[model samples]
Every structure is written in structure tokens, then in C-alpha cells.
Target: MQSVTLSLFRFGPLRARLWALSQMATARFALRAIPDIGTVKLCGSGVGEGFTPVPDTSVYAILATWPDHNAGRRAMFGTRVFRRYAEMADETLTIFLTPASARGRWDGQTPFTPQDITLDGPVAALTRATVRLRSAGRFWKQEPAISRAIGKDPNVLFKVGIGELPLVRQATFSIWPDTQTMAAFARADGPHADAIREVREGKLFREDLYARFRVDAVEGTWGGVMPDLTRRPTSMTNQMKVAAE
Candidate 1:
């Protein structure tokens, strides 16, 4: 079976670099039009007004499903559609993952199918939620501090926030070297734990879905330049408002 890939792009923060979601509709349309494309989504980040206070207008992302590895690679690395996004941003990062377990629905259907993996490697996680209007404030209240904690945690390989709607619908995608490390960051003492508790107690979201996957590859660049994916970005300080829309 062909593996799935999730390509991310974070552009440089320049006033001239700002581009709204509406303007990119054509690009999103073009990608879906690709014959091999499966489940594809375009999202905005919440580093600004939506959730996290600190943000960058330049950052945006792409999540895609393909028929196979070759199909994904052909579109992302070779197609004109992908090139336009890369050229517009000052920085961009993309990673590919193989699903290990997926449950629940996304837009009514499960977009990712779990696949058996017989290898030892890194792990990736995705959390999606539809926030209830009444609880939106409380949910966002915990984001800034938690985001900072994740950004500072050495165990985290990389993570990003992306969503269909600013605060009402949100999702996070993160990678960890191992499950132990991932749990360490999400455990009792941290901001993550606090947020988890509030959600359970307060019923913050009307719906949610989470999944784990096996790492396939972490490649590509950000800001017109490629950086080492094995380690944190050299300019990590600027990414403080790292959550998505």
C-alpha cells in the first residue's frame, strides 16, 4: 500500500507575506484535482487572534492523503501546485507518516486508515476537536502555556496547530521520538495535563478525534531554505505562537 504524507509549511513573518485562506482556494482546489489525491485539507494557524496570542501571519499548512508514496511525492515534490506554496513562504516544513491506528470521523468519514507496521521508529500524533461555543474561552486559556511547554520540551521532534475554523474547530499534529517521551510531556505535572483535566471536567469540545502513526519520513524545508529535521529549528524562538487555526 502507498504511505500517506503530511507536508507542512511555515512562512516568514513579513507584512508583505500575508495571504488569507480565501486567496488560496484555487491552490487547494488544484491539489484535490490531482488524480492520485485522496484526503486533502488546507488549514490556518492560531498563533494570532484565534487561540494562542503570539502568532505569525506567514505560517500555514497542508495535510494530504494519496493513493501511494509515489503519488504523494510526485505532487508535493514535483507538481506546480506545491511549488507555488513553497515559493510564497519564507519557510516551510513537510513530513510523511504511516498510520498505525485511526478511529472516529473527520468531516463525517474517516480520512486515514490504520495500517500494520512491522518496524521500530519514531511516532506521530494528531488531535482534532470541535470546540463548543460555551467552552471555547476555557480551552484557549490553556493553549498558550501548553504550547510553550511543548515547544520547550526536548522530547518533541516537531509540532504544529492547524484548523478548519479558528477556535471552534482546531487540531494539533506533533511528533515524538517515542511514546514514553510523548507521555512525559502530556503527564500530570504539565500544562497539557491541566488542559486535559479541564476538557474532561468542563466538556470543552462537542467532538474530537486523535490518532497515532509511525514515522515514514521528515523532509523538506521552511522559509525558502531546508533545515535539519532531526533537530529543532535554529530559529526556534520565533515559533513561540506555534498552534494552528
Candidate 2:
């Protein structure tokens, strides 16, 4: 019954954006005070579909874990920090998820507890890594190609690059219609696959975690468009294709 929430906030106007940036430090205090909230991370996005050095000042994300779906919803909709964020954002999207599979660790601690349930519909993939300082240059060089590959993929329902720290600590969250499609992108002969090979062969990440989740629900809109998880292979594909075009 454990659940996770990934909330994306888009701020408009210089003041709101500045406030969002400040929350990167200040929100942690508020989040820590929440009773049922477990592991929480406030992340900043990178430019143009993420995986870059330049920061996107307008967008930020909150990733939190809770005891159950109800607890997660309460924390998101009822907590002071989340309420303040909702009041200021131009548009926001929150995805409710149940971990289906997980491995490795974040900040040396496991964040998600996977359930013994089958994931048959839309699945989300999250990968977080702390890049080695010496491997930073090589890691960054592959980012553009990797971003371009994922950007061109029609099977990807949603994707964004976010990180706890600039440059060194990086993470990606993506949604696909099913696990097969998600795995296809990773297994394909492309920049992503190449990067995976290098990461394993060269020890690029100092710490890393990869997790898959069942998409329980999606709320609100991202970039003025609400992601409809109800529509499966057909409509979703068409919608994404149109967005890409």
C-alpha cells in the first residue's frame, strides 16, 4: 500500500520563479515536519527535456514517499509546503505511483518499497545517479545525444531531467504505455544504450538507483496539457506524436 508522488511545478513571472528556487532550500524544512511523509527530494530541472548543464529556472519537482495512497494524497493536497506551491504555480502535474520493482539506493538509502503486483498498464521509470567527479566530462558529452534520442521516441509518454545537485547528481523520470515499450527505448541501439554500456564499464556513477512503478493515477496538467493515462496504445501514441510534431 506504499505510494509515491512526483509533482511537477511550473512557475510564471520572475517573482514566482525566484520563490520556487528559494524553496529548494526552504521546502526541506517544511517537508521534514510532515508526519506521514517518508523520503522526500526537491529537484530542479535542466534545459529542454533535461540531461544538460543549464538549469531551467521555471520548472521544479517534488518526489515523496508515503505509507499509502491516502497518506500521499493528504501530504500533497493538505500540507503547507505543497499548498503554497500550488497557489503560486502556473501549471502543475502530479503522478501517483506504486512501486512495482526497485533496486540500488539513493543517498545510500533505499527510498521505495516495491509491492508484489503486476504492472500491466502504463509504467513509469525513474533513474537517479551521482556521477563521479572525474567522469563528469565524459558523462556530460553523452547527454545531448541521449536527450535527443529520448525526445525523438514516440513511445515515451512523459520525460524530464531533474537533479538534486547541478551537474553531478542527475535523475530522469519517464512514463510509457507499458514496460515493453519502456524497455525497448533502453535496449535500442542509441545514445541511451551506449551511455549504459559506458556507465557499467567505466564506473561513471558513484551511487545509482533504478525503479519502475505502476501508474496509479495522474492529476492536473503539465505545460497546459493533461496527460491522459486512461487512453492506451492508440490515443496516447497519437497524442504524443502530435505533441512531438
Candidate 3:
């Protein structure tokens, strides 16, 4: 079973500490060196948007698509580069997901193939965009409003903004209780709808991609707390135990 892992790291409160982590730019090179990884993207957050920029000065994340569980586990624990990351970060939360429907290109390729997932629990979604310079101001303006809307939505389980470039390239990773509820939030009259309309009308993005997945397991805490809608809990313990060994 191919698996996608989104791991977020919170370094600490010092600006210098956050700046020091920029060394990750060089370390990410090691991820590409892994044979079992199908695709991997090193990401940070945007300014006002969570998907702001990297060397984020506080937090950073990795979105990796693996061939299977064993491959991901081996790399997470066995790799020196990855071990250094864990050693530095104050807290790390890694979530595991299996794709149900993926319908876009990520860096010119589809990293995940849509699967026949039928899970009735929390569903995760990832939306990424490469905004054109001309439309960037408009895109940034709409983000905070859209983010507020998402925060207010009751169905939201967990969400984060992550990106490669500080402002121009951005992505959002969020989860909901189910597909229907997730769709409903998008349909509701809010900044989300407004942003969509504006994005199309303004030609906001040079490229954009969206995908939904079945949340098979979440193996860590985001802030000493698991996602609110999590349906399975043991996955974290099992994965942690393996890492500890």
C-alpha cells in the first residue's frame, strides 16, 4: 500500500533557531536519494497563509509519497538526514494517508494514483497552487479571508498551510469528517467560494492541483493533540514504537 506522509515540525521560539533550520534546504537533497520514495516535496509556509514560505523561521514540513509502509518507516528511522531533523525539532506530527481520488499535477507529475478507497471516516484534501506574479497580490489578499472561513467551519478536522516558495507557491492540507461534509464546506457562501470565483476571473494561478484522500492513519500529535475527527488511534502508538526500537 503506497502511503503519503505529511510531517510538520515546530522548531522553537527563537528567530535564530528558525533561521538555522534553513540548512534543511541542503538536507532535502537526501530525500531524493531514497529509492523507496515515489515523490517527495520539501515545503514551508507562506506569509499570512500557513503555506507561506520555508525556513519558515518557526515551522517546516515534508510531503512524501512512499511506495509502501515499510519503505516510509525505514527511511524515517534509518536515514541520518531525517534523524537530524527529529533531533532538532521541538515537536513533530506526521500523518499517514491513502489516496482515494487525486486529480492534478504536482511538479509536472501525478504523485498519487486514485484508489478505490471507501472509508467512511475523516477524509484529507490537499490543494496546491503556483501563482503567477501578476496575480499574486490578489491571491494573497484572498487567503486570510479564506483561512478564516475554514477555521470557522465546523467540519474542519485539521488544516495547515504549506509551500515551497515564501508567497508565490502555496498549498493547503486539510481534513474533514467525510466527503459530503468536506464538499458542503466548500459550497457554503464564504471566502472559499469568493476565492474560487476570483481565482478564475483574475487568472490567479499559473497552475493548481487538488486531491482528496482516505485518512487511514495519523501517527502523531500536532500540538500534543491528535486531529479532532480521528477515527483510529493505535496507528500512532504502533508507528512510534517501531521508531523507538
TM-scores, all candidates, are 0.81, 0.92, 0.89
Quantify all predictions' global Cα lDDT against the true fold: 0.69, 0.87, 0.76
**Top of the candidates by lDDT:** 2
Candidate No. with top TM-score: 2
Candidate ordering by lDDT (highest first): 2, 3, 1
Off by over 4 Å in 1: 12-16, 48-55, 223-245
| Model 1 C-alpha lDDT per residue in residues 198-240, reported as the tens digit of each score | 8889988888778887766556665455533433343332232
All-Cα superposition RMSD per candidate? 7.4, 6.2, 2.7
lDDT of 1 at 94: 67
lDDT of 2 by residue, 1-245 (tens): 88899999999999999999999999999998998899999999988564678888999999999887677777776778999999999999988888999999999999999999898888999999999999999999888999999889898888899998999998889888998998888899988999999999999999999999988777789877888763434344345334434
